[model samples]
Target: MNMNMDWYRIFWHTAKLGNLTRAAQELHITQPSVSYAIKQLEAQLEVKLFDRLSKGVKLTSEGMEVFKYVEKSFTTLQSGEDRLQKLKELSAGELRIGASGPIIKHFVLPLLDTYHAEYPEVRIRLSQGKTSDIRERLKTGQIDVGIVHFPFADHELTVQHLANIQDCFVVGHAYQHLSQKPLTAHELSNLPLLLLSEGSSTRKYVDQWFSSQGIQADADMELSSMDMLIELAGRGYGAAFVTQSFVKQELAEGKLFQLHTKEPISPRAVGFAARRDSTLSIAATRFTELLQ
Candidate 1:
């Protein structure tokens, strides 16, 4: 037999209130309309659902039995709706992120902490690598989004500018007594420098700047990890070329000092990158919104 959900809704409401007049008032219908719905449901079910009393009404045993099932069904339906609403509100889902070391430590990590506090059920997956590797993952659909340094060459990716990161030379406390006055790019060439590995974007920018000024200096050392560079610089190994944001705490704590250069290294554009053709997951979109 065909059954309407509205009929069940009416029946559920009447069962809860146990009075036709009260059920009608609660459902914003007239008493006759409420009675007619009950009659129709009873006719379809072939059962007596209610026993009329002087002041109110009560459910028959059969009505109570049917209602137990209805109550469970409707409860489950409400629960399903609540879960969907939470997903819409960004309380669930997963966000996959790709970022270089400095960006992850200095920026993305703090933002992720905030995101987690607000959306505990949303899972965040972070992959750390060089800027080039991160960009490659974004293109290949391995990562939903990336934090990269610019002059990126990808024409098919969308870039959203977040901040400008200033590059500087950091040194150990032993160099603290050195002149704070800015030195020309030529003078900077004289300092032994602990630099990031050759292919890194930071290294590329430094190389280009030196080339522009007609001064190519020999590196004191080359390291693959930013943490290693920072540690070596703190140990008075040599000056390390790094972003200002990455060493702010070290500079403040006197573990590292910034070496001023006359031709200030141009700031790199730091931002979010996503493939042009891909749709972002719900969690990724929410996190991106938070970044902005």
Candidate 2:
């Protein structure tokens, strides 16, 4: 049966007040409009909803049952509106981010700390993976933002250049003498190399650098973790290619020394990536703004 939902609303108020005139006053309508709406609702339901009295009205048995469901539905709708308002105000909700372990430790942590301080109610989720893994997470809507090495291109993702990072070869006491003189790319390539695994962005960048100088450098050891590479390099296992900013403490304390190269490595960009078509959550948007 065709029914006007407003009739149910009018029926609810009329039943609650037990008077047509009072329901009309509450709904800001005339008494006749309230009476007509209840009549229409009763007609559509094929049941008598109310019985007229000398001074007011009384709900029929069926009218009381319908009121129970209508009241619950309105309450649920009101609760949903309240939740949305909280999210929009940044007082609730979650922010998900993805990045490589080194990037998270050296770069993203500070920004996350600031965001958490300001919005303590918002939950933060972090996922550690390689740049390619981050890209996949972003496309699948698993993460709200991704911190990645620059020069990465994907039509499905939007990237914002955040900072510049310089990659350099470093050594420890065993190879400290190499730091005294600037060596050409070929000279540096002759030494044992400690490289990240093949598919990683840093590995790709380092390989391209050697290729440009007509050197096909080979790694004596390859590892997935930057921390492991740095630790091994500090023991003089080999020259570790790493981001300079990540080892400031080690470099300052003489635990590791930066190797000087005649061919200066150009600085590379680091950036924030997000799905091009997805709108960021309020917490995610605020976090990005904090970094900016």
Candidate 3:
């Protein structure tokens, strides 16, 4: 129990070489030191480790058994060190990310593309869920990083501001009149609206905004995916409240029109999250830098 690692290290080298003089040379120590270390090791382990021979030395039966474990342990230690070095250099590893559906579509996809191009060896795994779900994953070390919508608490996470997002009501060309002129809260209320389900942070934010303006917001249709909202809005199903960034394609192509509101929606942000106390993996840190 009083033995230290140096004795095992010396014994490992001495046993591997099977020559005390050669082991001493590899260890940059003298022959007596090698002899002394092997004696210390055999005494500590309570076994005869080597048999002296005319040429040099050879393992005893017990020595060979212990060498098997010692050899495997050294090999594993070396492999671990090599793996750690590779990770530090960003050469190999997987990056697990947590994101919501809309954020992935609008923001994370392009970032992933660029990250892959730069570090092709890094594997990216993405899990999509709501902001709260993503945060839970980040807290539990299930994911390396998360790009999520914010109005979130700063308790367990380190938040990095990524982009400002504007939410607005949009409709297809069938509702042309709603495009040019800003509508009052009461006027907006009268229109058939498509909204995300209550569990979503977007839904909560929009609901709070409407309540602050003294109007109770209700949706004629509720859907989970933002892409679905955009598509249905394009087909003139109803005015759907969506992040403007996600709909730049539909807006530019004249498929969807952004509605002007008398009470304009204030912009929010998409932020990235990592656990506050833990260090980010090299792959995750590289991806975050790419976003910056």
Candidate 4:
């Protein structure tokens, strides 16, 4: 049967109120229109939807089954509208973020602290992964935004430069003598170099740096964890290539010392990334704006 939505809406209202007059008042229509809609729906469905009563009407057995589906549909639609309203007012929604662990700890956490203080009602979700993995998540609509350390030039993502961070070779008090003099590429290569493993973007950046200087500082040890790298470097296991900002406490406490390089490693950027063509949700957009 060719059924109309208007007729079903009216039938839903009439069934809920159990009175044509009350349905008309709620739907902002006349009583005759409400009655006509009910008649049309009943005729189209080829079943009696309501039984006439002295004061009002009540649903028939068949009508009760129809009403069940209609009630669920309208309730879900109304819930969607309510959620949209809350989102528009910034009182409800979720913000999904993807980031590397170091970026989260050193950079994203402070911004999140302020964001939470301002929009405490908004739910925050965080996922940890490498830059490549986060980029894949964004492209697939798994996360809303990401903060990563990498080369900003890319076709796969819409990225914004967030902060300039300097990567350096750091050592501990056991190797403090290296800090006294600025070492050249050859000089730095001679020292035991602790490098992050091959898969990471940070390690790739460091690898390219070495390549640019016409050398490969052979890794005395290759590590995957920045924490362990820092810890071992602090104990003078070797000079670890890491971000300068991440070791401020160690530097100030004299546990680790920053190695000066003659061939300076240029500053790299921390980037905020999202899908190239995807539209971010209201909460995600607002949180991303803070980084701008």
Candidate 5:
């Protein structure tokens, strides 16, 4: 189309006010300039945009259709401009974050709390799911950054290791009567165990460790939430496999005891992931800095 944005704006104003003189005054241009712009636009589109009415002007069928789109475009442009202005003024901007439930609860929440305390005007939007799920969101631009466990497979993303995590089997005070000596993999296989759902990183790591020792675990229950697993273990449901840091408070308070393992589980890296080429929001960058 030969019509430029300037002509579209002129046509939009004229259609709204239904008078060339009024539109020109609103636009701070001469009436002929408004008329010429509309005429040019109509000629380019090969459609009559306005019908000369006795009192003023009325949109023809084609004019109404064009005006409908122009109206929506201008509204959207105005909204974008307003948002940009707000961002420039530091009055508003959204921070989208992706994380698993455990990480969000144990790590992201505290950092976000501190961030919100400092920047109360910034809006935070959090999405929680499995590490793989969060990774997908990060890749697709659905979230600005992700808090994920280590060993993520995506090569296109940049990762920053924030903390080292150790996995441990925790049991309640009811099991305190057991000896404090380290339990062999073969011995642990015979005890009732609570674990995360199959295919989870935690579950995979546990399974690998057990397999290497030629032991078959007696998994009595599968739970989705680490908090629930801790609660159940505290109630003597079974020995639950969880991150040591996650249950540090329970361990310290004597509500739970860590079962001695013949071989301590290797520590895994927990960290932030972001698209290699995407620009991060100020809030997200600041939060990442705190994690680092």
Candidate 6:
């Protein structure tokens, strides 16, 4: 019927208080205004909603029936508003995130720890995958934010640079002598090279770096996991290309040694991305702010 909601609001308070004056006081309106609204409502519904009494007013049988649904609808609306406030405050909500395993562990974990500590009521959903996979999830609305290797280019996403990452070749005791001096790209390529498997952003960057130096990076061992590559490289399998920050412990402990190249490897970056068209949930926004 497209009736005015103000009429029903006045009716609810009036029915509850059983006094038009009190309803008007609660609504911050004149008693005559309350009476006029009630009259309009009754006329629209084509029913007597209240019985005028000397003391106050009483709901008619028809008014009681209509009140039931009105009460439920208003209650539901109030509940929705309360939940939205909680979400806005970051006291309750879900944060859906996606990233590669290594980035999640080395880059995103500390930020998550801070976020969780502050907003313990927020539900965190973390999905581990390649950068490409993370982007796909963002596109499909499966994830609210994505942590990926940059410079990531996607017209559909708004990306913010989080941190810089340096990729270098690491080796074990078997190749200890090679780390003594900066080797040429040809010399480095000729050594038994270990690398992350194809289809990863890191792998693509490494391949491009080698190509730019006029060398072909032929991996003696290709693996899907950076940890596996590090493990294999540490066991003296071959020199592995990996993020420098991720192998700090091993480097400090002399388990894995960083190799120097005659040509410096270009440093890349890590960034978080979200769909440009969608608004991030409060929890996600706060988490990203913490990361920043």
Highest TM-score scorer: 6
lDDT of 6 by residue, 13-132 (tens): 999999999999999999999999999999999999999999999999999999998888889989999999999988899999999978988888988988899899999999999999
Point out where model 6 deviates above 4 Å.
Answer: none
Candidate 3 at residue 98, lDDT?
86
Candidate 3: deviation at residue 88, Å? 2.5
Clashes of 1: 0
Task: Write down the lDDT of every candidate, Cα atoms only.
Answer: 0.87, 0.91, 0.88, 0.89, 0.87, 0.92
Best-performing candidate as measured by lDDT? 6
On TM-score, the stronger of 1 and 5 is 5
Return the number of clashes found in candidate 2.
0
**By lDDT, highest first, what's the ranking?**
6, 2, 4, 3, 1, 5
Cα misplacement distance, residue 129 of candidate 5 (Å): 1.4
- Which pairs clash in the backbone of model 3? none
TM-score of 1: 0.70
Residue 212, candidate 3: C-alpha displacement in angstroms: 1.5
- TM-score, each model? 0.70, 0.89, 0.92, 0.87, 0.72, 0.95
lDDT measured at residue 256 in model 6 versus the true structure, 0 to 100: 90
Candidate 1: give its CA RMSD in angstroms: 5.6
Give the runs in model 3 whose Cα sits over 4 Å from its true position.
none
Q: Tell how far residue 123 is off in model 3, in angstroms.
A: 3.0
lDDT of 2 by residue, 5-78 (tens): 78988988888899999999999999999989988888889999898999999988887888898888777878
TM-score of 3: 0.92
lDDT per residue (tens digit) for residues 1-292 in model 4: 6859899899999998999999999999999999998998888999999999999999999999999999998899999999999998789999999998788888889999999998899999999888888888888888999898867556868888888998999999889999999988888888888988877888889888888989877889898778788999998898999989999898999999999998889998888988878889999999889988
- Candidate 4's TM-score: 0.87
Taking the tens digit of each residue's C-alpha lDDT, what string does model 3 give over 36-141? 9889888888999999998889999999998899889889999999999888777889999989899897789998988888778888899999898898899888
